[model samples]
Target: MDAKVRNNTAHSRYELTVDDATAVAVYEIRDGAIAFTHTEVPRSLSGQGVGSALARGALDDARAAGKKVVPLCSFIAAYIERHPEYKDLT
Candidate 1:
């Protein structure tokens, strides 16, 4: 899982490709905030931290862009809860 996440702005998502499988975190920008709406990781990639990596990358992007975060996706919300360093993003 050395793959780096990329922001696909045209598609409104962050993507991480590993072993030909791609995981995504879908989001929408509203009122200067990035609202994460969904997260998906291939079943074959589950339990391998793909989702966590995606979430961290997305949140880091948001921070870099000076945008707040609205974690509408349950997975993202849970990730933030676990990683308090990103709590201020919400």
Candidate 2:
């Protein structure tokens, strides 16, 4: 769907919008780290790699900002687990 993830810092979440549906990866900043708390992809956007995109974008942003990652969200944790390149952020 060519969805691009964007960090909505004012709301503390990463968002991906497509076809009028928005997916979000919610997070909280604590102890100088980004802690992903929840992730939700609209059913319409499921099975389309939207979640992975959101997780990847969020993690990449954290890496670029030099912020440690605390992936409290199961989806995000599993994403990182599968992508070993991001292991150092944990």
Instruction: Identify the candidate with maximal TM-score.
Output: 1
Location of the lowest summed lDDT over 10 successive residues in candidate 2: 1-10
Query: Candidate 2, which segments miss by more than 4 Å at Cα?
Result: none
Which residue pairs does candidate 1 place in steric collision?
A: none
- Candidate 2 matches the true fold with a TM-score of 0.96
Q: What lDDT score goes with residue 46 in model 1? A: 95
lDDT of 2 by residue, 1-86 (tens): 57788999999999999898999999999999999999999999899999999899999999999999999999999999999999
CA lDDT of each candidate?
0.95, 0.95
Among all windows of ten consecutive residues in candidate 1, which has the lowest summed lDDT? 1-10
Each prediction's TM-score against the native?
A: 0.97, 0.96
What RMSD does model 2 have? Answer: 0.8
